[model samples]
Target chain A: MTEHTVKSFDDELTHLSNTISRMGGLAEAQLAGALQALANRDSDLAVRIAASDAQVDVLEQDVQHFTVRLLALRQPVAADLRHIVAALKIASELERIADYAANVAKRSLVLNQQPAVKPVGAVINLGRLVQTILKDIMDAYVEQDVAKAIGVWNRDEEVDDLYTGLFRELITYMMEDPRTITACTHLMFMAKNIERIGDHATNIAETLHFLVVGTPLKGARPKGPSVEAQ
Target chain B: MTEHTVKSFDDELTHLSNTISRMGGLAEAQLAGALQALANRDSDLAVRIAASDAQVDVLEQDVQHFTVRLLALRQPVAADLRHIVAALKIASELERIADYAANVAKRSLVLNQQPAVKPVGAVINLGRLVQTILKDIMDAYVEQDVAKAIGVWNRDEEVDDLYTGLFRELITYMMEDPRTITACTHLMFMAKNIERIGDHATNIAETLHFLVVGTPLKGARPKGPSVEAQ
Candidate 1:
C-alpha cells in the first residue's frame, strides 16, 4: 500500500478501535446504571438502561462497517486480520454484556417495586467481582496487557464461588418462603447474567492470549467454571 | 473473474458451509451427550462428552483455516464476504457451545461419584431446549431461513424459563440442605452453561438475520429470566 493509503487505513483503524472503546465505556456505564437501579430501586434508571442499549447497538453497526471497510481496503493479513476479528468479537461481547446489564436493569424495575426478598449479599459481591473483571479485561484489550488478561481469567473463580453461594441462598429463599420466588427469580437471573459476563471477560482474556502467544494458555483450557452452577 | 474461478469459489463456499454444518452436527451431539450423562448419571458418557469436545476444537481450527484461505484466494466482496464472515461466527459459537457441553460434562464428573441430590428434570429440560435451538440455528444458517432463525431467537425464552426454574429448585434444595451445596452447585453451572448455549444459539439466529437481510433483527433481546435463576 502507498503511504497515503497506509495513513488512511491507519487512521480509520485507530478511529474504529477508539469507537469500540467508547462503546465499551458506554457499556460499562450501562452495567453500573443497571446495578445502581437495583440497589437504589430506581425504575427510571432501569428504563434508561433499556433505552440506552440502542447506543451500543449503533456503535456495533458502526464498528462492523469500519471493520469491513478496513478489510476491503486494508486487506489486513495475519495479525491484522486477527485484530479486526478480535475487535468484532469484542464488540459482540460488549454489546451482549450491555444487553445483560439492561436485563438486570429491567429485572430491577420489577424487583424494586416488590420487597427485598433476601439480603442479596452474595449477589452484590458477585456483581462487584464481575465489574472488576470486566474493567480489567477491557483494560487488557486496550493496553494489550497479557498479564492483566491472565488476572481477569483468574478472577472468574471468585465469581464462581459467589455465584454458587448466591444460588444456594436463592434456593433457600424460595424453599423457605415461596412468596419470595418471583423476586428471587429476577435476582437469580441477575446473578446468572453477571456470571456470564465474567465468562465473556474470560473469553476476552483467551482472545488476548491467542493474539499474543498464538496458542491458548496451557492447563487453562476454557473449562466451565469448576463450581457447580445449578 | 473467470468462470473457472467463479465455479471453484462457489465450490469452496459450499464446502465451507458443509464443513460448518458437520461441525454443528458434532457439537449438537456433544451437547446431547452431556445432557445424557446428566440424566442417566453415566460417568462414562460424561467422559465421552469431555473427549468429544476435541473434535469441535479441531473443526473450529479447520473452519478458520478454510475461511482465511478463501478470503485470501477469492477476496470475496459484498454479500459473499458477509457469508464468509457469518460462517466464521457460526463456527465460533458452535465451538463455544461444544465447550459448554464439555463444561457440563466436566461438572458431571465432579458430581459423578456424589449421591444424586435432586432429580435432573430442570437441568435435562434446559439441555434439551438448548440442543433444539442449536440445531435450528444451524438449519437457519444452512438454509438461510430467516423465519426459522427468528424462531430460534424466540425459543431462547423457553431456555431462559428452564434455567430460572432450575436455579430456584436448586436454591430450594440448598436452603433446605446445605450439605448438597457442592454437588448442586456443579449441577447449576451445568444448567447455566446450557442456558448460555441457548444464548449462543440466539447469536447464530442474529447472524443469520444479518446475513439474510443485511441488518440485525429487532426484539428477541437477551435477558435474565425475570422469575428467578436459583
Candidate 2:
C-alpha cells in the first residue's frame, strides 16, 4: 500500500474506533438514565430512555457499515483485522447493553404505575454496579488497557452476588405480602436485566482480552453462586 | 483470482456454514433437553444440559477462528464478506441461546428439589414454543430460506404472548398459595429464559435476512405485550 492509502486506512480505523467509543458513551448514558428513572419513578424519563436505544442501534449499524467498507477497501490484515473484528463485537455488546437498559426502563414504566416495592432500592444498586462496570469496560476498550478490562471481568461475580441477594430479598418480600407479588415480580426482572447487563460487560471485557492478548481468556469465568443456586 | 484459489475459498465458506449449522443443531438439542428436563423434572438431564453448553461455546470459538482466517486470507468482498460476518453473528446468537437453555436447566434442578408447582405445565408449553422457533430459525439459516426466516421473525409475538400468559398464571398461583412462592419464582425465571431464547431466534432470523437480502430488517420488531406490561 502507498503512503497516502496507508494514511487513509489509519484514518478509517480511527473513525471506526471513535464510532464505537461514541456508542459506548451513549449506552452508558442510557443505563444511567434508566437507573435514575427507576430510582425516581420517572416514567417520562423511562419512556425517553427506552426510545433513545435507537440511537445506539444506529451507531452499531454505522460501525457495521464502516467496518465492511474498511475491510473491502483496505483488506487490512493481522492486528488491523483483529481490531476491526473486535470493534464489531464490542459494538454489538454495547448495543445489547443499551437494549437491556431500555428493557429496564420499560419495566420501570410498569413498576412506577404500581405501589413501590421495598426492593427497588436494591435493584437500582445493582443497576449502578453494572453501570460502573460498563464505564470501566469502555475505558478499557478506549485505552487498550487489559488490566482495566480484567478488572471489569473479575467484578462480574460481585454483580452476581448482589443480584443473588436481591433475588432472595425480592422473593422473601413477595412471600411476606402476596399483594406485592405483582410489583415484586417486575422488580425481580428489572434486577435480572441489570445482571444480564453485567454479563454483557464481562463479554466486552473478554473480547478486549482476546483483542489485546491474542488469546481467549483462559479457565472458567469467575462466578459467584448463581441466583438459580439460591 | 485463479480457479484453484476460487474453489478453495468456496470450500472454506462451505465449511464455515456447516460449522454454523452444526452449532445451531447443538443449540436446538440443548433447548430441547432443557424443556424435557423441566417437563419431567429430571435433574440429571438438567445437569447434563447445563454442562453441554460448553460444547456450544467451543463451537463458537471455532466459528470465530475460522471467520478470522477467511477474512485475513481471502479478503472476501460483497456476498462472501456478508456471509462470513453473518456466520459470526449467528454463531454468537446460538451460543447465547444455549446459555439461556443452560440457565433454564439450572433453574429446573432447583425447582425439582422443591415441590412441583401447578404452572409447570404452562411453562413447559412456552419452552416448547421457543424450541420450535429455534428449530425453524436454524432451518432458515441452513437452507438460506428467506421466507422461513421471516416466518421465524413473525412468530416472535406468539412466543411473547404465551410467556406473558405464563407469567400472569405463575404470579396468580403464587398470590393464591404463598407456600409456592419460591418454586413459582424459579418458574417465572424459567419462562423468562425461554422467552429470551425466542428473542435470540428472532435475532438469528434478522441476521439471515441481512445475509440473503443484503439489508437490515426494517420497521419495529413485532412484540406482544411484554410481561412487565401485565
Candidate 3:
C-alpha cells in the first residue's frame, strides 16, 4: 500500500471512532435529560427528550455506513477487524439505550399527570445510577480500559438489586392504596426501562473487553434473571 | 479467486445462515413454551424455558465468531457484506427475543405462587400474537421475502394495540381487587415482555428488508409511544 493510502485508512478509522464517540455522548445526555424531566415532572422537557432520540438514531446510521465502507475498502484484519465489529455492536447498544431513555421520558409524561406516587424518588435514584454507568462505560470504550469495563459490568448487579427493591415497594404501595395503581404501574415500567439501560451499558462493557482482549468476556454476566421474578 | 475457494466461501455463507435459522427456531420454541407455561401455570415448563435461554446465547456467540471470521477472511463487498452484517444484527435480536421469553417464564414462576389474576388470559393472547409474529419474521428471513417482511413490520401495531388494551385491563383489575395486585403486576410485565418481542420481530423484519433492498424500510414505525402513557 502507498503511504498516502495507509494514512487515509488511519484517518477513516479515526473518523469512525469519532462518530461513535459523538453518538455515545449524545445518548448519555439524552438519558440525563430524561432523568431530570422525570424528577422535575417537566412534561415539556420530557417531550423534547423523547424527540431528540432521532439524532442518536441518525448517528447510529452514520456509524453503520462508515464501518461498512471501512470494512470493504480497508479490509482490516485481526485487531482492526475486531475493533470495527465492536464499534458496530456498541453503536447498536447505544441506540437502544437512547430508546429506553425516550421510553422513560414518555412514561414520565403520563406519570406527571397523575398524583405523585410515593416511590418516584426511588425511580429517579435508579435512573441516576444507570446514567452514571452509561458515562463510565463510554469512557471505558474510548480508553479501551478492560479493568474499567469489568468494573462497569459488575455494577449491573447493583442496578438489578435496586430495581428489585423498588419493584416490591411499588407493588406494596399499590396494594395499600389501590388508587395509586395507575401512577405506580408507570413507575414500575420507568424503573424497568432504567434497568434495561444498565444492561446495555454492561453489553458495551463486554464488547469493549472483546475489542481490546480479542476474547469474549469471561464467565456469565453478573445478572441472574429478570428482576420481575422477585 | 480460484473456483474451489469460491465454492468454499459459498458453503461458509450457507453455514452461517443455517446456524441463524436454527437459532431462530430455538427462540420461537422458547417463546411458545413460555406462553404455554403461563397459560397452564406450569412452573416446571417455566423453569425449563428459562434454562433453555443459554442455548440461544451460545448460538449468538457462534454467529458473532463466524461473521467476524468471514469478514476478515473473505473481505466480502456489496450485497455479501450487507448479508453478513444483517446476520450479525439479526442474531442479536433473536438472542434478545429469547431473553424476553426467559423473563416471562421466570415471572410466571412467581405468579404461580400467588392466586391467579383475571387478566392472565389476556396476557396469553398477547404472547400468542407475538409468537406468531416471531415465526412469520423468521420465515421472511429464510425466504428473503420482502413483502412478507413488510407484513411482519406492519403487524407490530397490532401487538402494541393489544398491549395497550391489556395494560388498562390489568390495572383496572388490580384496582378492583387489590388482593390480586402481585399476580396482576407479574401479568403486566409478562404482557410487556411479549410486546417487546413483537418490537424485536419488527426490528428483524427491517433488517431483512435492508438486506434484500439495500435500504431501510421507509417512513416511521407505526408505534406512537410507550403503552404506559395510556
Candidate 4:
C-alpha cells in the first residue's frame, strides 16, 4: 500500500493494456491483409499473414504471464481483480481472433488455386464489419466504456444477419454451379470465421461490461435469425 | 498459514472441480441427446436439448464467480494458480462446446421439419467421434494427465479428416439432387458444429497441458487435409 507499490501496480496495468492494444493492432492488420489477399488472390500475402500469427501467440503468453503475476502478487480486489481477469480473458479472445484471421488467410491460400468465386465482395464486406467491431471492442476495453462495449455487443447481430444472407447466397451458388462448390465452400468457411470473430468481440464486450459494472450482463445475447431453412 | 485455512482452500478446490465435473456431465448429455435427436429425427428431443443450454450458461457463470473469488482471496501462486486459471479457461471451452451441441440440436429441429437426408448417419458418426474426444479431454483435465490430454489433442485430426470427407459427400449430394439441398445444407452446418466441438476439446487439452507443465504445448497442432478441393 505504499506509494511505490501503488505506482508499480499501476505501471503493470498500463503495460498489460498497451500489450493488448499492440496485439489488437496486429490482429486488425492480419484481418485486413487476409481480406486483401482474398480480393487480389495473393497467396504470398496470405502466407505472410499466416506466418505473423506466431507473434500474436507469443504476445498472448506474455499477457498471460503478466496477468497471473499481478493476480498472485498484488491480489487486486473487486474492480481491480475484475480488470485483471478481464485482461486475461480479453487476451485469450484476441489470440483466437488472430487465429481466425490466420484461418482466413490459410483459406485464401487455398482459394487462390481455384477460379475465384463471385461472392468475394460479400466476404470482404463481412470481414470489414467484423474488423470494425473488433476495433470498437478493444477501444471499449482500453477506455472501460460500458456503453461503447454494449454498442459493439449489439452490432454482432448485424454480422450474424449478414452471415445468414451470405450463407444462403453461397449455398445457392454451390447448388447452381457444381464447379464453384469448392471455392464457395472455402469462402463459406472464411465468412463463418469472420462471423466468429464478431462473436469473440462480443464476448470481450461482455467481459468489459462485467469489469466496469460489478454484475454480469443480464439477459440472453441477441441472436439473429438462424441460417437453417424452414 | 493455518491448518483451517489450508483445509478450507483444499475444500474450495474440490468444490470447484466437482462443479466443473457436473457441468461437463451436462454438456456431454446435451451433445449425446442432440445426436440422438438427429439420428431419430426427434424434434421434441432436439428442442429440449436446445432449451437445456441455459443450464450450462448458468454453470459457466458460477465457475467464473468462484474462480475470481479464489484468485482474490487465496491468491494462489505457482501450480495452484495455474490450476485455477486452467479451470477458468476450461469452463469457457466447455460452455462453448455445449453451445455447439445446442446449435446442432437446433439444426436437428430444422432437419426434422424437412425430409431426412440420407447422410444423417454419417453426421451421427461424426458427432459421436467428437463427443468421445470431448469426454476424453474432460477426463484429462480432471486427472491432470498431460499424456492423456495430448492423446486427445492428436485425435482431433481424426475429426477433421471425417469432416473433410463428409463435407465432400454432402456437397456431392446437394449437387446431384437439388431436392436434397435444403436438408443437406443443414446437415453440413451440424457437421461443422461437431468439428468445431472437437477443436474446443483440443483447446482444453492444450490448457491442461499448460497447467500440468509450466509451458504451453509446443509445435503446430496437427491438422488434417484441407477441405478445399485440389
Candidate 5:
C-alpha cells in the first residue's frame, strides 16, 4: 500500500518471474535432449535424461514455494494474482512435459536394440512442432506478448493435423506388414505423447492470454478427438 | 489468536471438501453414463451425459471462485493452505474428466450412426475400470484413506494394460476389414479418453496422499518406455 512497499514488491515479482523462466529453460532443454536421445538411439543420452530429471523437479518445487509465499505475503489481486497462477500452471505442465520427453527417450533406447522398422521421420516431425510451440509459449510468457501466445495456441491445430497424417501412415504400415507392428506401436505412443505436449503448450498460452487480457481468450470449448483415426 | 474465527474457518474448509465430493459425484456419473451409451449405442443416454456436463462446468467455476476468495480473505497457512491448493487441482482434474465423458458421448453418437465393427465390450470394460477407480479415489479422498488412495493409484497400471489390449484388437479389425476403421477409430479415442480419466483419478489419489501424509505418494516412476513394446 505504501510507496516503499510497492517498490520492494516490484523487485520481488521480477525475481520471481526470472526464477520461473529459469525453470522453463531447464524444461525446454530436457525436451530437446530427450528427442535427440531418441533420434540417436543413445542409451547414454537416455540415461542422462533420466538422471537429470531431478534438477527439473527441484526447480519446479522452488518455483511453487516462492510463488505461494509471494501470494500469501503480498496478497496480490487481479493481474498480479493471474501472473502467479499462470506461473503455477506453467510449472506443472512443463514438468509433466519433461516427463514425457524422458519416457520418449527411454523408448528410443529400447527401440535401438531392434532393427529399424520405418523411418521415424513422422515422429520426429511431431516432436519438432511441439518443441517449437513449447519454446514460443515460454517466450510469450516472459516477453508478455499476447500476440505470440495466441500464435502458439493457433499452431496446435497444425500439430494435431501432422500427428493425424502420421497415424494414418502407421495404420497403412500395420495393414501391409504385421511384422512392423512392434516398432509402429512405439511410434504411435511417441506421437501421442508429442501431441499431448502441444496441448500443454496451448494450455500455457491460454494462461498467458488470461494474464494479459484479464479474461479467457478461448471460451473453454472442448477439443474433438484426434483426427488420425481412419 | 481468535478462537471464534478459527472455528468458522474449520467449517469453511469442511464445506469446501463436501462441495468437491458433490462435484466428483457428478463427474463420475457422466463418465459411467457416457461409457454405457457408447457400448449400447443409446443416443438418449448420450444426450443425458452431454446435458449434465453444463452443471459440472458451473460447479467447476464455483469451486474456482470459492478457493480464490478463501485464499484472499483467509490467507490460509500450512495444512489449511495445502488442502485448498489440492482442492483447486482436484477440481480442475474433475472438470476435465467430465469433459472427456462428454467427448465419449459425442463419439458415441457418431459411432451409433454407423454399423458395428466389433462388440463394444472391450471399450465398455475399459470405461468400467475407469469409473470404478474414479469412485474409489473419491472415497479415498473423503476418508483420507492412504491405503485406498494407493490402491487406486496402482490400479492405473491395469487401466493401461486394458487400453493396450484394446488397441491390439482394434488394429486387427482395421487389418481384417478397412470398413471397420471408422468405427474402430471412434472406439479408440473413447478408450484413450477413459485411460486419461484413470490417470486423473490417480492424480486425485496422489493429492489425497499428499494431504493426509504431508508428502506425495511415489508413483511408478513413469515406466520408462516399454522394452516389450506392444
Candidate 6:
C-alpha cells in the first residue's frame, strides 16, 4: 500500500477505536448512574439511565457498520483482521454491559417503590468494582495492553466473591423476614447483573488476548464460585 | 470470480452451517439431559452434562475459526456476509445456552443431596419450556426463517411468566420452611438460568431477523415481568 493508503487505514482504525471509546464512556456513566439511582432510590434517574441505553445501542450499530465496512473494503490480513474482529466482539460485549446496567436501573425503578433494603450498599460497591474493571478493559483495548486486560480478568473473582456473599446475605434476609423477601430478591438479581457485567469484562480481556497473540487464551478461565450452586 | 470459486464458497458456507447445526444438536441434548437429571436426581447425568459444556466450547471455537477465515478470505457482501456474521453470533449464543444448562446441572448436584422440593417439578417444567424454545430457535436458524424466529422471540414472555411464578413459589417455600431454603434457593437460581437461556434464544432470533431482513427488529424487545422487582 502507498503511504496515503496506509495513513487512511490508520485513520479508519483510529475512528473505530474512538467510537468504541465513546460507547465505553457511555456505558460507564450509565452503570454509575444506575448504581447511584439504586442507592438513592431515585426513580427518575433510573428512568433516564434506561432511556440512555439507546444511545449506546446506536453507537454499537455504528461500530458494527464501520467494522464490517473496514473488513470488507480493506480486507485487512493477520493482525489488522484480528483487531477489527476483536473490536466487533468488544462492541457487542459493551452493548450487553449497557443493557445489564439498564436492567439494573429498571429494577431500581421498581425497587424504589418499596422500602429500601440494607444490602443496597453492597450492591452499589459491587457496581463500582465492575465499573472500574470495565473502564480498565476499555483502556486495554485502546492501548492494546494485554497485562491491563489480564488484570481486569483476574479481578472478576473479587466480583464473584462479593456476589456470593451478597447472595447468602440476601437469602438469609429473605428467610428471616418474609417482608424483605421481595426487595431482597430484587437486590439479588441486581447483584447478579453486576456479576454478569464483570464476566463480560473478562470476555473482552479474552478477546484482547486473542487479538494480541493470534491465539485463544490458554487453560481454563479462572472462576471463583458458581452462583447457581450457591 | 469463476463458477468453481463460487461453488467452493457455497461449499464452505454449507460446512459452516453444518458445524452450527451440530453445535445446536449438542446444546439441545445437553439441556434435555440436564433437566432429566434434575428431575431424576441423577447426579451422574448432571455431572456428565456439566462435563459436556467443553464440547460446545470446542465447537464454538471451530465456528469462530471458520467464520473469521471466511470474513477475511471471501469478503462476502450483503446477505452472505450477514449470514456468516449471524452464524458467529448464534454459535456464541448457543454455547452460552449450553453453559446455562451446565450450571443448572451443577445446581442439581447440590439440590439432589437434600430431599427434593415439591417445586422441583416446576423447575423441570420451566426447563422443558426453555428447551423447546431453544429447539425452535435453532430450527429457525437452520431454515433462516425470520417468521419462525420471531415466533420463538415472542414466546420469551411465556418463559418469563413461568419464571416469575416459579420465583414466587420458591420464595414461599423458603418462607414456610427454613429446611427447604437451601434447596429452593438453588432451584431458584437454576430457574433463573433457564430463563436467561430463553433470553439468549431470543437474542439469536433477533440476529436471525437482522440476517434475513438486514435490519434490527423494531420496537422494544418484549419483556415480561421484571424478575428483580417481582
Q: If ranked by lDDT, best first, what sequence of candidates would result?
A: 3, 2, 6, 4, 5, 1
Over the stretch A92-170, how does candidate 3's per-residue lDDT look in tens digits? 9999889888888898898888998779999999988988899999898888899999999999999999999999999
Lowest-sum lDDT 10-residue window in model 1 chain B: B221-230
Per-residue CA lDDT of model 6 for B1-230, tens digit only, reads: 99999999999999988998899999999999999999999999988999899999999989987887888789998889988888888899998889988999898988888887899999999998998899999898888899999999899888888888898898788777877777887887788889889998999999989999999988777884363421
After superposition, candidate 4 runs with Cα above 4 Å error: A217-220, A224-230, B145-147, B213-220, B224-230
What docking class should model 3 receive?
A: acceptable
Assess every candidate by TM-score: 0.80, 0.94, 0.95, 0.92, 0.84, 0.93
For model 6 the local lDDT of residue B129 reads 92
lDDT of 4 by residue, A1-230 (tens): 89999999999988988998898898889889988989888989988988898899999989987887787788788778877888888888889889888889998987888887789999999998998998898788778899999899889788898988998898788778877776887788788888988888998989889889978788778784364411
Please name the candidate that would achieve the greatest lDDT relative to the true structure. Answer: 3
Query: Over the stretch A113-227, how does candidate 1's per-residue lDDT look in tens digits?
Result: 7788654556777877788788888888889889898888887777777787787788676657656665765677688888878877787788887776666766654445353
lDDT of 2 by residue, A14-113 (tens): 9888999999999999999999999999999998999898999999988987876676666677788889989988999899889888989999888887
**Model 4 Cα lDDT, one tens digit per residue, B1-230:** 99999999999988988888888899999999999999988989988998899899999989987987888789898888887888888898889889889989998877877887799999999998998898898888778899999999999888888988899898788778877776887887789888888988998989889889989899788884353311
TM-score (C-alpha, index-matched) for candidate 2: 0.94
Per-model CA lDDT versus the true structure: 0.78, 0.88, 0.89, 0.85, 0.80, 0.86
lDDT of 1 at A196: 77
Per residue, candidate 3 scores C-alpha lDDT tens digits across B63-171 of 9878877876788987888889999889999998998899899999999999877789989999889988999999999999999999999999999999999989998
TM-score of 6: 0.93
Ranking by TM-score: 3, 2, 6, 4, 5, 1
What is each candidate's DockQ, to 2 decimals?
Answer: 0.20, 0.47, 0.49, 0.38, 0.26, 0.43
Docking class of 5: acceptable
What ranking of all candidate models by DockQ puts the best one first?
3, 2, 6, 4, 5, 1
DockQ of 4: 0.38
Error of 3 at A54 (Å): 0.9
